[model samples]
Target: MTVELRVLPPLLVSLAVTVVLAACTRVPPPPPPESREGFPERGARLIQQYGCGGCHTVPRVPRAEGLVGPPLTRFGARSYIAGELPNNAENLRRWIQDPQSVEPGTAMPDLGVSETDARDIAAYLFTLE
Candidate 1:
């Protein structure tokens, strides 16, 4: 029992010293801040990529001042889209993805935009308000 007690204290002290050394050696990095969802940024890129500016005169989009179609400056505040469908997210995405499906004789062409891209573009356009 006497032999065991002498050795146990040393072992415990060594273990504690090792733990302290490890703690002092390197500092843990601070937790990263939650990144903002890249919704607006991604939406703007998609809008420009699909050439929406070709017809619609969208504000905040460089060189998007086309006069062929209706100006989408305050699209979010608008009650209707193309004077046909409601201006909600789902409707906006549907219109962007496939305009012909929404309106038979509409001038807006189906730009073949993906569902995700359409959603993102709509999210960005909504920010106009």
Candidate 2:
């Protein structure tokens, strides 16, 4: 009597299906976009409109060329404002509203950002990191 062994093929196929299903089940969806609660798209537009990037190396703005001010690539992650005030949205807004008030000798000018604009700019800046 001769016995045929067809069991190995089915076992291999079952194992492959199990592996594929496992792989598919384990994958996670991508994370959602960062919150823009305080940051509005208009603020990003204003950043360009006001030419803030000309003096500061603002992220995501193009044609920005000026060496007058400090680079602001990581301004959001900074711990202090002008090396004095605590790094917070309110402080950033105040600084933007009036830089000289924060630091008497600082060369950063007041861009005439309104309360709303300042908030938006601060929100955008906070997203740098």
- Per-candidate Cα RMSD to the true structure, in Å, reads 16.2, 10.1
Off by over 4 Å in 1: 1-38
C-alpha lDDT of residue 50 in model 1:
81
Best by TM-score: 1
Poorest lDDT segment (10 consecutive residues) of candidate 2: 28-37
Expressed as tens digits, the lDDT of each residue in 50-76 for candidate 1 is 888888888888778788898988776
- Model 2 residue runs over 4 Å out of place are 1-37
TM-score of each: 0.68, 0.67
